[model samples]
Target: MPSTLFGFTITDHKKVFAIALPMILSNIAAPMLGLVDTAIIGHLPDAIYLSAVAIGAMVVSFIYLLAVFLRMATTGYIAQSFGADNLAEQRQHFNHGLTLAIGLGIAIAIASPWIIDFSLWVVQPDAALIPYASTYIGIRLWSAPAALTILIALGVLLGRQQSGRAMWLAIITNAVNVMMDLVLIIGLDLNVAGAAWASLIADYVTALVGIYWCAKALNWTPALLKIIPDKLSQYLNVNGNIFIRSLVLQLCMATMTGYAARYGSDIVAVNAVLMQFLMLISLGLDGIAYSVEALAGAAKGQQQPERIRYWCKLTLVWSCIFAVFYSLIFWLFGAQIIGLITDLPEIINKAENYLPWIILLPLVGHWSYWFDGVYIGLSLSKGMRNTMILAAGFGFLPLWWAGMPLQNHGLWLALSGFLLMRGLFQALWLRLRWRQVV
Candidate 1:
């Protein structure tokens, strides 16, 4: 017989860790790749290389992250389907997600020239860095299809509780990216372009592997290709809300980077490194979020409010614990962490100055991360969308505007406020709609 604790099955903890740990490892690879990029470019003869890569990569990341709805929507739908024992619906959602991913990716690729021009215009990098940034984006934009395809595949695997497979895919992709970064950049003297090509190749390779795994997990059938309009409409609705939420968040990030650039390349370099710490922590918290998506969605499908509550309670507990752990690590090794990303004394000095914000980030930011998982798992996109809008508009913008006088310090303050308010607002919204969500 099954045992229970704290309104949860004794096995709940095992289920959560089983999904969360692999995802944490897999998600770490993402920022680890970014760190590798920074380290590679940071070593070049000039700081301009680092700045250009930072701006260029941020542009691409903003684009890809904006489309993150493709992954989030697929995960929610498939997890629900899995819980309801609707294998056919699971396969259908996967196909629909893959189709949308391919279409969106191709659209992005076709629009690259315009995107490149617009991004360059908006960022307005130093004249010396423009060519490098353009070259990197121009080459890298070609991988949009492969990158988005991998997103869809990862969503399918994760929603089905096959996180270990997703972990392998992440490992393979990051490993290839690292090896190619070394070979192409250091070995062949390709410079920033080498980094772009390395990422392009790795994305394509991972997409292929992910697609194969997805097929194996859900046997291929012609029926899978049949698109259902009602289902697609539902998918689009959820994805559309997520897109708005994500776009607002990305705008905040881009604005932060743009403001940092205005301060000078050293500030940009410092913030770039510091942002990695935030990214690392976010990814770690997101592991728990991913688990919430699966377990909570499953519970929702089964109409078990108690199970959902148990998941929320259990995951939130672990999320806070990890948040504290991250804060401690940053407090203890903050200097060494900065040193590993870049060797420039000036950049390292600036980063250490701002290290306190990074340390405070995990604590102030963890709640928003946890709420995001719960919202996604519950498929409560509208509430998520509304909270993000509130956070970004009322919470972030005014604070950021006021802090502009403080320069980078002001920027960090605004960012910290934005994160904290997102959580606060989410909590408020959840309280107001507790019955609907749970």
Candidate 2:
């Protein structure tokens, strides 16, 4: 018999690990797409190439990441459909998401010129960097359709608990991005434009892979969706809330980066390295959240409230366990990790001062990510929306302003508050009003 924890057998928790392990690795690898681009571009003769790529990558990644609501919304609907054992609805959900993905992608591509101009104007790049940045941005924007398709495809896979497939698709996509970086950026000597093209090509390739995965994974139910006008309205309403939530979350992140910039280049440099640490932790925890989302959605579909409770409690226990380990690992080797990223002595020294925040981060902030899975699975978009607003607007912004005197420390403080509040508010709302709302 397998060992037990918290009143459940290890066998029971395998349900979660089965999904989380591959996903954790995949989530970790996801960053490599951008990292590879930056790494390869960093080798170019002019530092301008690196700066231009960074600006361009940021804008593209921002939009694609924001549209992740497509995945979240799709996952909620798909998992619930899977729970009902209604393969037809699952197929329909996938089709609807794909249709929406393609439409939005084309729309974004057509608007690319205005997007580039507005973004450049807001950013006020070094005058010299504008042409290169604009070039990279323009090229990358065309891949929006493909990139959004990947998100939708991933949603279908994960919602069905086909995480292994999702993980491989992620790995394969990044590998392609890296390979393209070599050919276009290095081999073709295209500089930043080459890097942008690499991403565009890789996105379409991944989109094709996503199509293949969806085809191979689904059991080939022969039915079609008409984009049902009413269904589309429902889709928009659900995802629109999620979009607002995503916007608030991204805005909060941007606010942090802006604050870091105001603190000076050294501070910004330090925060950049530290943000990698944050991103990795968030991504790792997100792996577990994936399992929570699918399992909880299935439980909801089965009309089994107890199963949902079992999962929420179980995930909470494990997340806490991870919190302890994250703290220990970062506490022991945070500096060495910083050294791996940059050789600058000044940045390294400054990074050490803020190392405590990174260590403290997983402990305080991880719950929000963990609970996000629960909320998404239940299709609790409104709760997700409201909590983020409350946390960022009421909690984070005010705290950030009041704590401005402390500089970076203040930023970390406000962020810590924001992260902590997001989960706390969601937990309370779900606990008190879950039945009434859902």
Find the candidate with the highest TM-score and give its number. 2
Model 2 clash pairs are none
Candidate 1: where are CA atoms >4 Å away?
1-10, 30-55, 126-132, 179-195, 262-266, 332-336, 339-355
Quantify all predictions' global Cα lDDT against the true fold: 0.87, 0.87
Residue 409, candidate 1: Cα error in Å is 2.9
lDDT of 1: 0.87
Model 2: residue 399 alpha-carbon error in angstroms:
0.9
Candidate 2: regions farther than 4 A off: 220-223
Backbone clash pairs in model 2 (N, Cα, C under 3 Å; residues 3+ apart or in different chains), count: 0
In angstroms, give how far residue 232 of model 2 lies from its true place: 1.9
Q: lDDT tens digits, residues 1-438, model 2?
A: 679988877986898888888899888787766576578989999999999988988888898888999999999888888788888777778878988999999999999999999999988999999999999999999999999999998899888999998898888878887898899888999888888887788889888888877866665433554567788788878888999999999998899889788889999989889988886687668878998899888888777888888888888788887888888889999999999999999999999998888999999888998889999888898889999998897779998999899999999988989999998898888989877644
For candidate 2, the lDDT comes to 0.87
